[model samples]
Target chain A: MKYVLIILALLTVLTVGFVGLRGQTSRQPPVMVFNDLVDQPKYKNQGESAFFADGRQMRLPPAGAVAWGRTPDKPDPGNLIDDADYYGLKVIPLPVDAALLQRGQRVFNTYCAVCHGGFGTGNGVATNYGMSAPANYHTDRLRQVTDGYLYQVITEGKGLMGAYGPSIKPPDRWAAVAYVRALQRAGNAKIDDVPQNLRGELEKQP
Target chain B: MHDRRLVTEGIRVSRIFPKNSRQIAAALGLGVVLFGGLITAGVTYYFTPKYTRVGYTPYQPVPYSHRIHAGQLGLDCTYCHTNVFESPHANLPSPNVCMNCHDPAKGNIKGDSPLLAPIRDAFKTGRPVDWVKVHKVPDFAYFNHQIHVNRGVSCVSCHGRVDQMVEVRHEQPLSMSWCLDCHRNPEPNLRPNELVTKLDWDSAKDWKVSPLTQNTDSQEAFARKMVKVSALHPPTNCTTCHR
Candidate 1:
């Protein structure tokens, strides 16, 4: 019994010693450090910084700032009106590109059509949900506005309309503006003024 | 013979009584101690951080060095990963976008480190240059790069020193608390409206440019300015972070 007691006591002491050592060695605090580059410096010239970063500075390339890669002599379809101020607000011009127009159409269908109706008649799903009726693109007020003014309304957003600038890319926004103009023209086109190629098709209608 | 018998009797008594009890008790006690010790050790190991492998480290494609681009070149994170301020994605620039400059610059280089090779291959094959994502949170965690970037959170806040890193590694734990710390209290680095568009300012010369230069009194004026220019948005509500 005495021998058993002595053995048990020795085991207890060894176990306690092991645990004590483990406790002494196990704890560590996580290390956190801040970067100085982001902290101290402000970048001055974007183009210079681009070059310094081993990237090229595109200054007066063959194509202008708006022209992605179209030929200069071809009267690049991407160049639209350059009037900046329209309706007392600074306006961004829409690029005259088919692809951009298509992209803009897609974005409009996804985000705007739900609120402004697919044809921009102001009767969207949100209309029943307390949103005011959006202005119809076919209206004389919108048709009279320049393409620049339309671009501004789309970029900066008019009253009761949120800015689509953040939601859509600059190019895509321009495309949407083009599509809006297209919609307006389609709505206002006279039956007799239909294109010769399409007059036969329209005349065939009952 | 009697002495021998007595000696035998003494030996039996010593061996049978105290010694046997001691041996049996010692075995039982040792068994209990060992079993108890194992249980304790197992419990401790189970609760310890060392045993858990929640830390994820995934392998990437292309070995694109952020250190060379961001650190050495001093390129802004927003340049390539454009739309970080206005959109949800800190989008990887398209291969064509990369080729825009690289194609013209390195026309002479032929072999590896030819700067334009990856871009050329992408253009020729029509396959996108697949970049491995480093800082991926779970799908359930809806994190917007725009809100954080616009609201004064530096790229290094979550991405760590990406410019300095040769290989981009996930540095932050990227837990909810990590996001909330900044969301709850935004920094003063919130950029002004004009500065937002004019991203390539020469920092050396324009170091003293402050967002709050115009002095307009009244809370309404301040509010209007904030709405028009400041990047300060609301907190991370359920819809803000989750949706």
Candidate 2:
């Protein structure tokens, strides 16, 4: 009983000592020392003086006054409607413009014809070189796609074809998409009658 | 025999009573003191402001006022802190930028202007002014000024009413949890893309022009305007804040 009493007394004393020490540490204010005026040691002659001898001085620019380069007000192509159909996210129909088709045809011969062939039936020079066969643009899937979606696939590049974004600017890329759609339509055309100008050439071939 | 027995019993009773009472009294006294000390210590820890080695309130070379530029003049916060909406650092303006209008000196100095001394010194010495930072977050915390600014988080949300303040105080606690609160449930008042940099829109009397307009002065209007609309959205992942 006597030993238990002594042990308890010792524990109590230790607890009190710890509490007192903690209190003392908490009360002490944080020290802040302002450095006296001296030349910035890093650059001797060119250093900014730490303190000004004359208190009267010119006004500095306000805080947060950094000038920024102006961003141009051009439309963000990322938000283009063409992206809707490409991801199978949305379908926005665009009018079939002859000018767009002509532009598209030119772009296709330059870019797509190297892989998909001029006729677009997957017999391009790339296929002859043992590259992966380009898809036949006349497939039902291609036909069903909205013009916007087709444009997105061409501009952004789908599957094996890397994005043409770096090589083709926006207007040219959109033209290329229109051309692909034209190729698909031409391939699916029925051979009921050839154009009047082309009939004579067909007869000579036979 | 009766007298001897009574004397012996009294001596035994007295010894037991005094020693036991003294022990009990001492134990109670010690327990009270210890519990009281612990309560006091806990309270102090809870209430006291935590200070860092690089103290929050470092003396600035200039006493520039955000209140004048952003608050009263109704200038866009991004007008000066150009990269605040794009870069990590809301970079300090160069002395040349200040000299654009201020070389002529517009405002009258009351006694000694805190801002003027640094500018004059920089002009005389051909040295860049070294302004001290206020509202500094820990280095480990990656806070993007662009993300917040673009997402429609008002300058006032983090910096408090800086325009109202003469000498910018570290108004917000800027604790991790304080940031998380806004991230978790962003205020609804966030504006649309085009109007992100315009603060004058807040005081505009037009609401019919767009749904994004700030017509009403209610807290709800402000909260609604801060709604998040971004590609990344508002990421709550640990690496978002920690790294």
What TM-score would chain B receive for each of the candidates shown? Answer: 0.58, 0.65
Q: Highest DockQ: which candidate?
A: 1
DockQ for model 1?
0.02
- Backbone collision count in every prediction? 9, 14
Provide per-model DockQ scores. Answer: 0.02, 0.02
Per-residue lDDT tens digits for candidate 2, residues A4-56, read 45765676677566544221322222332432221123322122444644222
Question: Which number leads on TM-score?
Answer: 2
Q: What global local distance difference test value does model 2 have? A: 0.56
Off-target runs (Cα >4 Å) in candidate 2 are: A1-206, B1-58, B105-115, B123-126, B192-233
Candidate 1 stretches with Cα past 4 Å from truth are A1-206, B1-59, B104-118, B188-233
Which residue pairs clash in candidate 1? A42-B203, A43-B201, A43-B203, A44-B201, A44-B202, A44-B203, A45-B201, A45-B202, A46-B200
How well is each residue in B31-75 modelled by candidate 1, as lDDT tens digits? 787668766875574333222212223444455676765565444
Q: Residue B61 of candidate 1: its Cα lDDT?
A: 46
How displaced is residue B101 in candidate 1, in Å? 3.2
